[model samples]
Target chain A: MINSPERVAPDTLARVQAEIERLGFRPSRAAQSLKQERAGAWGLELNSAGFGRLGAILDTFLIELTTGAAERGSHVVPFTAADSAEPLPAYERLVASRVADGFVLTDTRRDDPRPAWLEAHRVPYAAFGRVWDDPGITSWVDVDGASGVDAAVRHLADQGYERIGYLGWPEGSPVGDDRRSGWVRATTDLGLAHPEWQATSTQSLPAACRAAAGLLDQLGLPGRSARPGRPGRSGPGVAIVCASDALALGAWRVLVERGLEPGVDVGLVCFDDTDIAEALDLSSLHQPLDRVAERVLHLLATGPDSRDPAGGLLLPPELVVRSSSKPAGNRTTRKEK
Target chain B: MINSPERVAPDTLARVQAEIERLGFRPSRAAQSLKQERAGAWGLELNSAGFGRLGAILDTFLIELTTGAAERGSHVVPFTAADSAEPLPAYERLVASRVADGFVLTDTRRDDPRPAWLEAHRVPYAAFGRVWDDPGITSWVDVDGASGVDAAVRHLADQGYERIGYLGWPEGSPVGDDRRSGWVRATTDLGLAHPEWQATSTQSLPAACRAAAGLLDQLGLPGRSARPGRPGRSGPGVAIVCASDALALGAWRVLVERGLEPGVDVGLVCFDDTDIAEALDLSSLHQPLDRVAERVLHLLATGPDSRDPAGGLLLPPELVVRSSSKPAGNRTTRKEK
Candidate 1:
């Protein structure tokens, strides 16, 4: 009767609820689960390499997911795979034991085995990244990196930066290529295409610095004198858009070493508005993590088949403008005012 | 009979186990919980301010805890308090619903209500930080910040640094004060007491930079000529020990702006060997998170009564040597070799 309040009379229901509150009575989760045939929990696999490192966004997403799960009268069970390369065993264990009713997947990559295994087993799951191996799978929500970078490029152009260059990761990574495509698209659209102006590096700081230094040389930035054989588009109006905050830090360090101010000497922007970006006052793209978490939960609750026929949701990131994107001329004019 | 193999005949047990494995007949967790009267899960509270920020160690700790719990045939349920200041209600909710058998606490602070509330209710719990409110509470595993800072100060002094300055957070935080105390003790012990050389700032980069810059000016560093009437201790042999990686970053920026390289120009060390420290190559104190996680799980399983009467555990942090702690003179000698 208490479980189904509608079955009781209104007056009796109120009286019984008051008495239960007075007695501090509550049903045990185990008993409730046994009756409901559900775990009331979701399994989240933690791959140390994917998160818990510096400047990773998954930690924030985990917090949001945990909070949202609690609000929806469920709990999040965090676990880790003994072997990250083959994580199906861990997922299978959780399912076999009935510890979780569903799973939330992250760090999605090409040739990933998880989506196929879950689908074959008829288990419910939702991914935070695109299910790269299967286009038919729409149970995922991811931030559109390409559109985010494009927006950043357009933002720099609007700020009057004529010679815009890109500092990005090595080609072949899906995310890296996605972000680079945005730069290519935006620059081509704006009639400021300089395909030779960009440089690639690994995520390491030193490598990024070396790459950024080389890119700066190609663009003829931080030096007023133009190279004899290179293009004449150089100096204060030049800007660089990085694929991530770590890459931006490298570029920022190089700019600092050359005695150049980020906004005044040259405009700068990067992806993933992490603390590094905020600390350095660099412009960046902010991922809509809260919306992503909400959508993932919604997909898990309402199976993919019950959802709209549309494909995976790709939300555009919002551009966060800071002092790094402001030109020196604009700052001087504002000061004069 | 399968649960208690000793009660069954050897041949019967083997045959039954084989049949169970062949059929993949694993017992349901909900049914097991109903029979065992335990949730088989531990609750972990996530306070956004306490973690999920840049350069925080809590995210790493969560991963370790999750992995440890799984090894012990348990799960960790992460939740958020609706009201962080008064988290007892959330704890009570979990207890009333029996969603978790015990709780694992983090970010323990002075006058913490959770310990007292848990004690009153006889709920098992363990903390990652010291339970500051009551001396009798021994269910905690904490990193000795004071000893870590002390070791850092001694390391700088051993490196032939004469004027060692301290960069720390504003007073009143228990953890910050504990770390600060180590610097005071170490400096006095080493006959290099200069209490006046310390500066405090919040965790923000700009505030830390301002504080660090002011401290450097007082020490007369980054300049060859000493200020008239001031002590002549400003030179390449000076060093600074910071309370955290964030503060060290501030001091690093100041040094970079003045064209002074870390280790070679000024020796530096900070606590929490986070990713920022590794990326910047700064020497830092590494907390033993794996041991901490193992101990926390032990406490949860054994309960407070089964443990030794000795107080809470305090593990010392290990110092990770990197380029930031090496002296310029030392590097020059190595180059000559």
Candidate 2:
């Protein structure tokens, strides 16, 4: 046994390998790699407690990610971080223990510490959301929230309503800012500019309702036309664009309370086409999570030794128009605003 | 060096161990156990594609389970099962590869092949739902759906609605049947025995809506008092206990269409207190999933060689009352039904 070629006879090694293959006795990842190769899993650190209101969206994204990874013969190892403020300890443990080959980060925020840690450790990873302040190159796949609001503006414009109002989350959220930028860009191109109709608040139903109330009250009955050649028309017919379906739900309730018909009097658009949007029959932007998951895996598959820099992908959001954005009639009704 | 105790000097071993501890250098789970003691992970198989409309409820349950597992110092390795019929392949791979020490199974059904397979393999595991037909000893933690529905029925009875109806999923489903049986037991106890008032259908909003419509039509108005001295009742004065919140949402819509006030004219109760229930303000049965998860982990911690037989737990569901089940008035108004 000691004098065998390379510690084991070549013929014996080949025979054992063949028998192992024949019996389909697959070896564990650690045993197969001699503890040097892939862990055969991907890490995902989640703030299980922090996703309170947005848990549905995050869960759907995770499901998609898991399905995509399974198709590629991998598993997603979900670990919990005590809180969002400190998520690095779990990632550190995962990497140090070689529990996963790489990771897929979600809920990326400003000055996020995860990307830098992974990068410094030479670990392969891809983020589902973008870090706003990070200048470093990284792999990420994000849906363009701004373009979603822009499309909503165009859709409402095509329906003959020009005065578009924005109801979004407060100033700091990268996602909220991106969505608000879409409204800004779309309205600028259309020349139906009414900047003062914009409103901002926290990402909650009550907060959105209060912000929507303020915007609607300020956007009260249109007295004069903003666009030229439409003197007969009242002020820009108002359409409210929200950062999320939750906000849109609140905005819809506000409209109902004010005796203003949603599809008839005001156009409402919500981002993140969740079931709430479907139940409420509100127009919303649906992110193609399956496609996003596919792209994320493709990016994360790059090994740490790869020479190429980390990649990035921005997917388009599909706008689903429901009764909330349906036109009441021809452009002639613009005067009724 | 050759004569050292256990192949290493005691002083050297102690110094190295102290340094490792001081550096907080978490050795890989494999290295920590001489690569044998524990995998430090648990297997959780999910059918991302098949959940469809019921995905939200499952997602919440998983989140709670993840939190509970994290508290116990373990990570959840989520994998995708192609379909419900064949969830064994993933579990087998996980166990044979030693990727996970054990599993926490969910969505267990009648004649489930999982428990038997795990038993045959002598793999440590516990199921979140019970096996209806399995006589073998197994560990499981399940919420009593029947008891949940019974509570809903009783809550409605106390609110002055003696003539209660039931809406549930079709027969053959262990969960659906269990929930339906609760309605049976509770109504029988209250002496409001109207078995004909029960309805069943697939679990969906439209399907439940159709079933609710049919039940409402069949139970048009109170012809004669099932109870004495309620002749002045304007309608049947019935409340519908649903197998799930999805069904309750549909029933609530039907009530709105029929111009019947949910809280005043009719009572509504839904099982599985999902966010949809909270959003629509319909009372529902809230399962204590955190406790269930903790129990599941405790059971799974037991190895196959343990002397104790497999354990089972049946936790009660708590009913949350919302505006949907408010009392119309005292028994004096019972005649109005």
Candidate 3:
């Protein structure tokens, strides 16, 4: 009678409504969920490797996702899989118990079991990374790493850095390869391609530093030049475009050790404008995480069946320039190369 | 009858159990929650400031909390307040709607409204940081920052660093002050007290670098000494104990710019062994996040009504000795003073 006011007499409806307002009555979410057969919550699998690290943007994405869910009168239930490699059991448990209406997937990689399993079970899910194994899958939103890296290279070129080197993760990872392609495309477009100027290393700082050192030597940085006899590449107008902030930190450390100022000596740019970049004053590409989160939640809300025909969205990252990418004329440090 | 097998006839129960097993039917969490008047979920408010930074440990804590909650058959529902300062409304909404049975609070500070508001409303909540305003409130589990800093100082001192200085945040924050007190206590205890050999800055890199330079100068580190006349403190056997990895990065940068290799030239130790510390190989205090999460879950499970007679728990962080704090004899870099 309270819900269907039309079934009750006008006087009774008014009295009951007034009493409810006076007593501050509110419906229980669990009871409502049961009646509607919806959990009103989304499961988010927290794979430890995705967050809690340098240059990690997933933590920021989580904040955006949580904030967005709240605005839509929903909650994000974070859970960890017992076995990260075999996460289907965790997903299945949530589904069986009806603890979540759907899931928000992240760290989507090649040959990942999640998308295929979720699809087979008719589970509603949306990923923050591309559905790498299946281009047919459209329930995802990701940053355009290739374009972001391309922009970084172009930005470095514009800053008067002639010999631009690339520092990136070893090939084979989809995301790393995608970002590397951008550097390739940008340098080729500018007719300044120096393929040998690049070097690869794992995400570790020591490894990054070693790779960066070798790359610097290849680019004809004085004192440690690997090919000192080679001509035309030796100069102060050199810059390095790194795939991640962690890699850029390695390059930055090499510059500091050589008593060379980053912007004043060698221009530097990196992807993922994380705290490391901000702290060290390095120019980096900033992913549109808020928009990505909004799109992901949209995909989750309007299941994969109702996804857009255009397929997964790839938003371009914005380049955040700091002192590291500034022209040499604006030198602040007194270090002489 | 399915749940209480003994209440039914043996034949009927056997048949029902077989059918249930065949169908793999499980009790709906939402329906169960409605019946029991429990949400079986804990709310975690993710303030942007607490995580996603150079020296943040909250992200790690979140992962640990999520894993611990899952083990206890509970979900951690992450949410964001419309106004972080007045977050009671968000908590109230969760309570009134029965979305969560309790909350796991983080970033608890003095004069925080959540503790008082939750206590008055009789809401079950446990904080990751101490309830600084009310000593009687014992629903928290915190890393003992003072003890952690004290250990770092002693560790640096043990590594043969004679002129030990501190780089910390500006005074007023309870956590910052606690850590600073540790430095003071340890330095005084070891008869190496140099009250003026310290500097404070906000958690920004540039500010930290400036402050660290000043502290290093006061400690008589080479050419930049503030008082050239001051005799006893000049040389390579100096070290800095930073309150956080972020601050340590700043000090590290200053040291790098002056061509001084860490460990070989100056010992360094910091708190919150975050990725920044790991990347730079800085020795730091690692908070027992897994243990902290376990304890926080325990507090939330055992509500304030049946709380322990003892006060809130303070777990000490372990000092992770990396290359940054090694003795000067292990010199790798060829830089000369």
Instruction: Report the number of the highest-lDDT candidate.
Output: 3
For model 3, the stretches where C-alpha displacement exceeds 4 angstroms are: A222-236, A330-337, B222-236, B330-337
Off by over 4 Å in 2: A1-24, A49-55, A196-203, A206-238, A252-266, A279-281, A303-311, A328-337, B1-11, B14-24, B32-34, B49-55, B213-238, B255-262, B305-311, B328-337
lDDT of 1 by residue, A1-337 (tens): 8869989999999999999999988899999998997898889999987787756888889889998888888888888999999999999999888899889999998999999999998888999999998999999999999999999989998889988999998988888899999999999999999999899988778888889988988877633234222233344388999999989988988887666778776789998898888888889999999999999999998975685469889999999998899886566443210
Cα lDDT tens digits for candidate 3, A162-261: 8899999999999999999999999999998989999999888889989998898888785424323322333548889999999999999988877667
lDDT of 1 by residue, B90-177 (tens): 9999988989988999999988899999989989999999998898889999999999999998988888887889999999999999
Instruction: Output the better candidate (2/3) by TM-score.
Output: 3
Give the Cα lDDT of each candidate. 0.87, 0.74, 0.87
* All candidates: DockQ: 0.59, 0.31, 0.65
All candidates: TM-score: 0.92, 0.83, 0.94
TM-score of chain A of each: 0.90, 0.83, 0.93
TM-score of chain B of each: 0.90, 0.85, 0.93
True contacts kept of 1: 0.83
lDDT string for model 2 (B185-234, tens) is 99999998798997887755567777888786666632222323322446
Model 3 pairs whose backbones collide:
none
Model 3, B1-337: lDDT tens per residue?
6668888999998898899999999999998999999999999888878778778888899999999988998989888888888888989999999999989999999899999889998889999999999999999999999999999888888878988999988999999999999999999999999999899998988899889888877876753243333223245489999999989999999888765768877889999999988888889999999999999999988888887769899999999988889875654653222
Top-down lDDT ranking:
3, 1, 2
